[model samples]
Target: MAEIVLDKVTKRYADGALAVSDVNIEIADGEFVILVGPSGCGKSTTLNMIAGLEDITGGELRIGGVRMNEKAPKDRDIAMVFQSYALYPHMTVRENMAFPLRLAKVDNATVTRKVEEAAAILDLKAHLDRKPANLSGGQRQRVAMGRAIVRSPKAFLMDEPLSNLDAKLRGQMRTSVSRLQKQLGTTTVYVTHDQTEAMTLGDRVVVLRGGLVQQIGAPQFLYDHPANLFVAGFIGAPAMNFLPATLENGSLSTPLGTVALTDRVRRAAEAADAPREVIMGVRPEHFEDASLVDAAALDRGASFDAQVEVLESMGAEKFAYFSVEGGEAHASDLADLAADAGSAGVPDTGSQVVTRLSAASAVAEGQPAKFWFDTDKVQLFDPASGANLTYSAD
Candidate 1:
């Protein structure tokens, strides 16, 4: 295992369009890092640059404390698992896994031992004789992973290896891949547009946008305290509910009602020199049906009644959607995020709120429902710069 570092790395096309710019990431030995962003956000370009498939426009690339900018892909000593299985249809699973070892002229016995070990780790021991044609999609992906494992390289690079599988299989493969990486203790860098994969698989996730690094941190950290409107909106499942608010006298005036900012939030906003008009963010999971919460718990938050536009029952929990009187919050960052998410054409006539409520709640579509959210969990962002205004000093 080895540490991989990108020091102020950049990639610019001949036409002068920057694919990646001033990117820097330090991946520790045996750590699993993921590069995630919307399509064309330069995540794949950054990965290819690390893999030595693309030339760096500037800066240095290092692996195991050695400069590797000029090294060829084969000389990088890293195993890459591509999105496509890239398996030889004619070769059986055992032969496919052993191919890398054979190319290195490893002795037959050693090759056999490595391939067998990898097959067992990937739970493919039963399908050693099966060709790629006879394997399930998940099994084929495991075969590709096994091929990489047999090489026993310094690090592993995977590019959307689970994108081709069905949703259920993708979830299953995520567990398998994470387990395999932990068992082998190999350094890994994964690239994917799927936030769920990025969240569940990596020790740290790198969020990118417009060829720039937006934020880098643990999944929960980024979710709880995003660096900007883009990161806040991009990292969550139902995404965050953004509402335009006016900050004055330690209180915020919003469509829901006036919210008295908590001391922590007030201090952060004051320290950041927050603007008078700010965007307030609340996650879906942070809200609950007001009637279901204890009175003591309700005292810590604010409640508002809204006409539920839609209610989705999700077994353990429920999602209630409502439309506030005010229209959607407007900003350049929001526009860019909408474009990146392929929802640029979707009309935003009103501010839409989605709240996660208890399954036992009595909320129903077209009925007036009371929703309460913790005031301390709210985040404030600068609309123009998209910077988090309520970021804690710590």
Candidate 2:
């Protein structure tokens, strides 16, 4: 296995349009690092650069501590599995898996041993003689993986390898791939636009946008403590709720009402080097019915009132959309809405605040509902800069 490092790396097309800029990251040996972002956000370009498929316009790329700027893909000691499952139509699964070893001129016995080991790991032993056309979509993806596994390269580069499978198959393959990676313990760099895939498959996720690194941390770290509005808005399922609020005295006054800033939240804001009007972000599962919610168990913050505008039943749980009581509601960042939440609208003249509510009780539309967001669960950001104001206790 090898550690991959990109130091101030950049990629610019021949037309001089910058696809990536001063991107620096390090992937440790045996680490599964995921590159996640929206389409056309330079994720694939970054991966291709590491795979030696694209030229680096600036900075250095080091694989196993060796500079690889001018190296060809074949010389990099790496294997790449793409989204399309590029298997040979005429080749049987065994031939496909053994093709790399054959090209390297390995003897027949060694080829058979390696191919059989990979097939056993991937549960493809029964399908070894079958052609790609005869395999199911999920099976074909496994064959693609099996081919990469037999290489035993220094690192593996996978670009959205499961995108072609159906949802159920995708879930199954996700677990399988994660297990296989642990067993092999190879350095891996996976690129994808799906947040679910990034969260489930990565040891550490590198969130990217506009060719810039947003944040790099474990999935839960990014979810619980986002660095900015972009990371906050991009990491979650339903996304964090952002409401306009003003900071006056030691309290944050919003349309929902005034929330007393505890010593912890205040200290964090002071450390961020900003004390201006702020944006309040709350996650969906953070809000519970104030009447029934346990304050002592939560032990961090205050509560607010909301008027229910819409309630969506998601079987096991429910999401409530309601309006805050004060000032008009508007979203300054479109990326937040485009990432997860639907959209912000001026219904009932901006008295509606939409939030995800638990399914423990029935909440009806157009009803005045009392909801409580755990104080510690709230995220604060500078309205001007969109930078998160949470200070890590580190």
Candidate 3:
């Protein structure tokens, strides 16, 4: 219903510790934007600042083209759905949805109409008489959503609203939330630590790190062309694989073997004055079982043999893990990513390269299998700054 803007917004605690620093983002009217990163990356703090739940130490916040820096949470005219359902145990679904209107002293007839409309939109019409205790997890979350929607606020701030649901239920709720947001067309800013949710649920994604803005773009753009080592590792499932390599004569020598740089990559790296020591990045999807590759297509790529340490059959595809000599690529940026993954309980598994192979491929664990990787899809990153040397703005 309205646009929101954070102009150089910053937050600093009394102890001189900064939670968010100089963040600038604009949410167009009815646009759904996501703020995503690892825990303590300041996404939730940024959302809290916007919802007026936290105070800004500097810069400005504007909603619907008006300053909101000094306004209270209720006065900001926004609705927030938190990780917790936070429903009143004593209230029925209908009463919970209508509570905001009741507090505003809206007439009974209008409140009833609005509550009914919200229930219908959320597919909760059948459960309106039920209490939170009687509902399933997903249903209770929908009830929470219904409560927020009845207010018809100018914007919605959601902080990991699907965090508590089971995996299947979370997936279903994601679809439901996407549909509901479009149907209502309210400006939305969602905060999440899940990269899957960040990729699937929003028009644009704003990636943050250590309270700093990393990159802002469409999900696919960030996936295909990350700005730095951290963004490259953070945006994808299984993350992008990094290999240490030396660049000379437009060719790279890596653990995977010698790779002739593609023209696009060569030019970009050359223009950036790339160092001889660089990090080569390749996405999981870019690699495939060599036997499955066409002979004609084989001319455009290269192949190497490695023993598969583990093989996971996923029906549609197979996830094959391999150990390469020289271990995982080492850099400060990469170390930070590893630390985050460890803290989040993601398996370290030592130095493994995860590749998505065709489901029909007969590769098995502990067997030497040839794998082919597309040369043109390779990306080069600066080892020191963690900046993508082969990044293209176009």
Candidate 4:
């Protein structure tokens, strides 16, 4: 295992279009790191640069404390698993897994031992004699992984290896891949466009956009305290609701009504020198049915009535959707977020909010319902700069 470091790395095309900016990331030995972003967001380009598949326009690339800016892919001692599987139909599972060892001119007995070990680790011991054509999608992916494992390279690079499988199969394979990586304890760098995979698979996630590093930290840290409007909107599942609000005298006035800022929030806003006009963000899970909250809890939050446009019963919980009277929040940063999330063409005349309520609550569709949101959980952002005003290094 080896540590990888990218110091002020940059990639620029002949047309002078920058694909990756001066991004710096230090991946520890045996750590699993994921590169995640929307389409054309330079994730794949960054991975390819590390794999020596693309040239670095500027800055240094180091692995195991050795400068590798000009080294060839074969000399980097890294194995890559692509999305296509790229297995040979004519070769059996054992033969495919042992091909790398044979290419290095290892003795026959050593090759058989290595292939058998990898097959056992991947739960493919029974299918060693079968060809790639006879295996399922998940099985084929494992075969590709086994081929990489037998090489015993210094690191593993996987690029959306499970995208071709069905949803259920992908989930199953996710568990398998995670277990295998932990057992082997190899340094890994995975690239994917799926936020779910990025959240569940890596020790740390790197969120990128427009060839720049947006945020880098644990998944829950980014979810709870995003650094900017784009990171806040991109990390959540249903996405956080953004509403235009006016801040005055430590209070926020919005369509939902006026909310008195908590002591913590007030201090943060004052420290950051927040503007008078700001954007307020609240997650879906943060809202609750007012009828279900305790009296003491109700005293700490603000409540409002809205007509429920749609309700979805998810067995464990319910999702209530409502539309507020005010028009959609207008800002260039919001527009960029919408475009990156594939919602640029969606027309919205008013703000829409989703609330996750307990299954015991009785919220009906097309009826007025009372929803309460905790004031302390709210996040405030500056409209002009898109910076989270309440953010702290801690």
Query: For candidate 1, lDDT tens digit of each residue in 2-115?
Result: 999999999999999999999999999999999999988899999999899999999999999999999999899999999998998989999999998898999999998999
lDDT of 4 at 68: 87
- 1-394: candidate 4 lDDT, tens digit per residue: 7999999999999999999999899999999999988877788888899999999999999999999889998889898888999898899999999988888789999999999999999999999999999999999999999999998988999999999999999999998889989999999999988888988999988988888888898888888888988788878788899999889999999878999999988999999999998999999998999999999999899999999999999999999999997767766668877887778988787899988999998999999999999999899999888899988766
Cα lDDT tens digits for candidate 3, 1-394: 7999999999999999999999999999999999999889999999999999999999999999999999999899899898998999999999999988998899999999999999888899999999999999999999989988999999999999999999999999999999999999999999999999999999999999999999999998999989999999999998999988899998889889998888888999999999999998999999999999999878788899999999999999999999888655668788888888884345554467899998999999999999999999999999899999999988
**Candidate 1 TM-score versus the reference:** 0.97
Top-scoring candidate (TM-score):
1
Steric clash pairs (candidate 3): none
lDDT of each: 0.92, 0.83, 0.92, 0.90
Q: List runs of model 4 lying over 4 Å from the truth.
A: none
| Candidate 1 weakest ten by summed lDDT | 325-334
In candidate 1 the C-alpha lDDT for residue 98 amounts to: 93
Error of 4 at 75 (Å): 0.6
